[model samples]
Target: MEFTITNVILLFAVLLVIAVITTKFSSRLGLPSLVFFIAVGMALNHYIYFDNAYLAQLFGILALIVILFEGGLTTKWCHVRKVLLPSASLATIGVIATTLIIGFFATYILELEWLEGMMFGAIVGSTDAAAIFAVLGNKNIRTKLKATLEAESGSNDPMAIFLTVSFITLIQSHEMNFLSLVLSFFWEMGIGLVLGLLWGKVAVWMINKINLDSSGLYPVLSLALAVLTYSTVSFVHASGLLAVYVMAIFVGNSDLTYRTSIIRFNEGFGWMMHILMFILLGLLVFPNQLVSIAWQGMALALLLMFVARPIGVFLSMMFMKYSFQEKVFISWAGLRGAVPIVLATFPLIAGLEHSQMIFNVVFFVVFTSALFQGATISVLAQKLGFTGETKAPAPYSLELVSIGRTNSEIVEMTIEEGSAVVGKELRELELPEDTLITAIIRGNKIVTPRGTTSLQAGDILYVLVTKAQRETAKQIILEG
Candidate 1:
């Protein structure tokens, strides 16, 4: 049957509708949305054979950029700053350790060639940020632990990508020395860092300085900047993914105009990308091929989930003051998702020897991970005493709009059990001149707060304050 544009549109629309429905039920089923979308693609592939590794790899790269951009944009700086050191160590040194351990397993146990083993290690080393964000973001995990996981997942992709590319190059060229490869890695990382930082500052500056007539256009501007950040870094032979993530972190944390709007838009966009990328990756796979490697793949996946990942986490975070339960949760939270499958496409695209084998193995590993680890992460967190009741979004919302360079934001706080605001009258607690308590909600009723009105636990308060005053306000409310 010949495919036409009309037919394509109809088919895509149907698939998307199916995806939307699957997503609605995903959380209830204890499955990741990628699992459903991928299953749909695999089902479709039975009737329509679509095996274009290069195209799949391209789309995966693009999807990763969007996913990481959104990850960065949504990350709260206050939380990230607290765990930055440990998270950075995990993203960098943790990735290397995971690769070596997994590589050794693949080489000695699986009897794969060293280069192929290394490639496999690199492909699946990093926990997928999209997967981590999707799974843990819904859970009521401790803020610091969640931040650390998200930051590691968001940042480690660059290291894994670098190692994968280097291994692929090593196999393909066979002439590049270890010293040369090391230099190349550093070069990519350093350039990406410089470009990302510069572009992030520039993007914040641009967003603040240029006010679009319509607030709707701000999302577009932000997205364009994000794309530019990735592309500019890539053009200079740097890590484009890293650049986009870093750029988004800077811009998202800054007090740019339409910051809230931009974040909301990207959240939607990121989900779309996730669905599309997973479907494409699923279509690229041959389920029959996965069958042959199923046992080996499961072994590798188990090895990664139970052994290498735990070592990586424990070693990277050993010096930190995290509790044993927290460390265990961190170790178990290394859920693989589309990134490994996506990176699998790299070897295929590079035309490396045993590339198909690598792809199929990676596919099985990712499936195992998403099925086992992803499904049980929240439960494990709860069991390990790392989780609490998930916080509900505020019943209502308010925000202070910025016209230009203002850093003010509408901040929301819940009156915790021991919060200083819990028993105080509004008049007793001194706040900055720029800050104001817009409204308070207790249970289902809105309390019109007066100077004499006493605050109580469980009340939700929304306050407007400059960026500089946000921390101070939180302290006063929480610790007064």
Candidate 2:
């Protein structure tokens, strides 16, 4: 196969088509699409050779920025607020605990030195936001549980990243300065948080004030800002991934022009990054190399899954209100994904003596975690009685597009049985000033709402209201 520009593009298109088709079937089979993506990449390696650790690491970092930002952008502040403290605890303390436990096990079981074991542990310690978001896609789990998992996964990468970098530095220098380590940790986290919030506000202001000529350009603007935020934060020696995620949350929650379009664009782009990163990573792995470490990899993975993860979760949430089953489920959901594999490449790039061995082990661990844990998450939720009823998506849709800043936006809500406004006409509900019911969806029909349109159970309402009046309007219609 000649690797000309046209031939390369043709190959890329074919891979994407295969990936999309594989995702559709993976959903039906209750498996994560990442598995198939990696399979595709590994299959391609037979014809096209690729093994550049530095390039893979660079691409992985970029993909993570988009993936993390998208996760934060779509997260609802209302849902995350209640679980914020617990999630933070899990992301920081829980990650540390998991690392230490796994590190100890690796030293004895895997017969590695203490530092090497800790480095290996740090590489795989945190739950992957990409895996969590992909696997838990509208699974109807308890709201708080889902929020905790999502928030923790989205935020925990900083701690793991910090630990991995610190260990690698220490290994290279053969020096252990505890005070410097502590200070560095604080510096990275503090700067990342401060800059994330500040940059997010600035980004939101830019989006609303610039008023781009074309609606399509709004998403492009957002994409540019996201990359800018990550790079800017990273240049200051801070956690760029953390900064990007925080900035995205701010932008996503704010009222701005084309907010919906921006989010949708990032969501689609994030999926593309996921597929590309996984496939590229798959191409880097050698099946024969993985087989050599199979026993050690399986042992460490089991230890992390059965022992380290459960202890970490329980300790982190001991003072919280989660039930025992919820805690167990949270432990089970500590899925490893692209992050660990990407982190593994760090060692290789650093030229560590056992870097290849570490990469292979980490890859195997992530593969096992994603396959076993990702596949059975829903079934476990059912058994634990944590599943909740999810409203079916409306067949009809409504979107609000603005070329300039607007305080008012569209909100969608479903009417449940015995709602206060049920059996009442739209005009009779006494909605807040300037509130307008745009459309009422009943069964298969989209009804343009009017004074004479009576609300009924199972109706989906799309209303336009100012940000300040949103809660008041919800109270009138939903709790009436």
Candidate 3:
């Protein structure tokens, strides 16, 4: 129980191990890991004694940067391209609509000042990328719907962050300038976008040109560049989180050396940040305070899920071409996670009259969202007929490690029944130029393919092909 460095480290390590172990139970119960992580933090709050709003906010922002960057890195441009416009609209206009709706409702429900109500709204406005990513990780949703949700979650934070800061200023200073606010929003977003794209290109070039002695250092280099990107953008009064996400998108999609390794490392690192952020947030809560605000928090959470989120989503995509079912699913999937809790710290730091109340409500809202919305995402997807066929990962894997940019890479394709390639020899199939079937996985055996080797149904093929011919090779193996 002593507050020493060794004790702190030991406590942290033990907590992490327990959190990791809880994932198995969480997954089995179809709940997001956040629930358990937060539970663990709350259970230890008595012994740990962590109530620093400033420190929690700082760590939350850092954790969010890594989490958002990882989300961007894993986002495929091809999938997001078609849904970009709708997603952007949701991220911006939808967020504003949601905030206003919730703010007005909160003003009447909680009898708070107008600005304070809006501040509460802004704090919980954006759908959390961390929560969305975690819940949808295994869900087989349609491509357009999935991409829209993912892209919106990844990009929506900037708008929410801007609004929260602006409202806090208005609340504190008791002044409002419409023109100035509009200009500031554009400046923050525009500068963040430009810087993200620019830094992404520069980072990719550096990674390829530097050619580090150790492959492990590639991840470190990326990690440093990400932090630098955020810090530099923030220094200029722009949205650092947006910049980080955009930069990661470029780095992830580029043909850089050790790209896979870098991505995998960030994925793991991002998970660690998620665990720490949620637990730290959980530690900040006092059970007695939560009980006092429990009724209001539950009412607000219900309003967000049933009323505000749906209205926001439908209105944002009014001109877009999405089915009613798709829209409904999207609305249901707006789960809140670390961002709202992080933003809640802002009010606390400002020492607002109702700041503690706001934090408790936000914390409760996030918990309810993770527990209810997170748990039912898959069932809703299926009920709405938006679920796609889920594929199990390949038992055997291959990575093409390189020290520099390479055109050729390994692609995996599963040979389903009724394929043209079935019962055909490798030499018999007219494969794409420069494409080679490196290995065939049949059941538990790894077959070293030869010219005479015959392909069969239920075979997983690893083909080495250049990016230019990648599609053609895929068509041949998968379709014919």
Candidate 4:
């Protein structure tokens, strides 16, 4: 027992340290750090490495709860609200269409029974939030694009899980019944949504009701509640992942105390969970199986790239006003990660034929998706003009960050359409004695502001406040 505990501690230390060093090194090379994490897991898998997939899956469930909760907390509701209807529609209709399309194609192409092929399709249909969040979440993408992807990733899993499990039940009985399957899907999804919203509402109330001894402890307490809440919901046959994600979104966006600090803690914890999950997932992959799966997986990925995804997104965006470029980029960014592997388990546990085949195909799909889609989304974003403004690293919590501040500062000076600050000479309203208004950027033009220059309602001023009194001068300038 001592030896086993010691080994666990040692392995964990090694993995954690390696994860930190590797992710930083990989990020410098413009590669997603997740690839490195997976490689390390594959390296560990060499020569037995415990020889059990279930153990890693057990860890996956625990890790996923944390991941889901963190995801919920980090999501911005302001961004999602603008596109909720379209995003929700895409999440539901898109998953169903993608599954059906793939299922029918697989039926003919793989010569499998309709039910079996449908199961295969269902397992891979939903995008993995963990994977998507890890790679795409931090980009300075536009609000609409980011929210659409975020909502889709967060909400689509229940649909996929339902479809996967429903087919598993049918295959076990060697039959398909329309009404029963429909009812089951309806109950699971409805329950998952209702549970997530309710859990989020309760968790918000709890966070507000309790005043912890330390502000720092709030994040820990909230996270624990999130995990427990998730597990409890799932035990009652609800979707814990969905529940926690929704809960986090509410708590994250709400006017709770110490929210800024809590968000930072959750963000850091979320990254660690992502690193651990990818590594565990990678360890479960047998490199030999990947070699055999290479062609089929690559082919399926192409279908995703050229056929299924385009159809899915096209149908999804039917009434939505997304530009063609925006739609195209969305179609291209559907990377896969852990959820498919988890769903693949239904086949194995249900004693379905060729469970190993399902696992192998999923492993391959996730690999291709991460490698191909993950690497290319940025390039396409630029090409499609969806990257809006120039990109910068998202700043951390403690220190405020700004770009191009060497000689200039972008401070928010509120000129309420017709305020005195708006129609005043820079010399008269002139702000601080030292500060200079460099440029007033409105929409996209650089209006050079002089002593007589005035601000506009929708204008954003580029005031060059000195390094000293950058704060005090802005306050005085605005007060003037």
Best by lDDT: 3
Residue lDDT tens for model 3, 1-480: 787999889988998899888887777677789999999889888777889999999999999989988888889999989999999999999999999999988887777999999988999999976666566666677889988998999899999999999999999999899999999999999999999999999999888667456667888899889999999999999999999999999988886666677888998999899999989999999977999888889999999999999999999999999989899999999999888999999999999998998999999998998899988987888888887777567577677443234456666678999988899888887887888888889997899999999999999888887666767888888888
Please give the range of 10 consecutive residues that has the lowest summed lDDT in model 3: 400-409
- TM-score between candidate 1 and the true structure: 0.85
The sequence of per-residue lDDT tens digits that candidate 2 reaches over residues 262-282 is 888998999899999999999
TM-score for model 3? Answer: 0.87
| Clash count, predicted structure 4 | 3
Candidate closer to the true structure by TM-score (higher is better), 3 or 4: 3
- Candidate number that wins on lDDT, 3 or 4: 3
Best by TM-score: 2
Arrange candidates by TM-score, descending: 2, 3, 1, 4
lDDT by residue for model 1 over 1-480, one digit each (tens)?
Answer: 457899888888998888988887877766677888888888888877899988988888888888888889988888999999999999988889999999989876657788879888998899876666556656677888888988888888889989998888888877769888888889888899889989999998887667465656778888888899998899989999888888889888885656777888898988888898998988988889888888889999899999999999989888998988898888888888877888898888888778898888888888888889878887888888887888787566555354344556566677889776678998898887788887888987888878898999888887777666777787787677
Q: Residue pairs in steric clash, candidate 4?
A: 72-248, 72-249, 73-248
Better of 1 and 3 by lDDT: 3
Q: How close is candidate 2 to the true structure, as a TM-score?
A: 0.89
Assess candidate 2 and give its lDDT: 0.87
Ranking by lDDT: 3, 2, 1, 4
Candidate 2 segments whose C-alpha is farther than 4 A from its true place: 402-445, 451-480
Clashing pairs in 2: 420-480
Give me the displacement of residue 322 in model 3, in angstroms: 0.7
- Alpha carbon lDDT of each predicted model: 0.83, 0.87, 0.88, 0.72
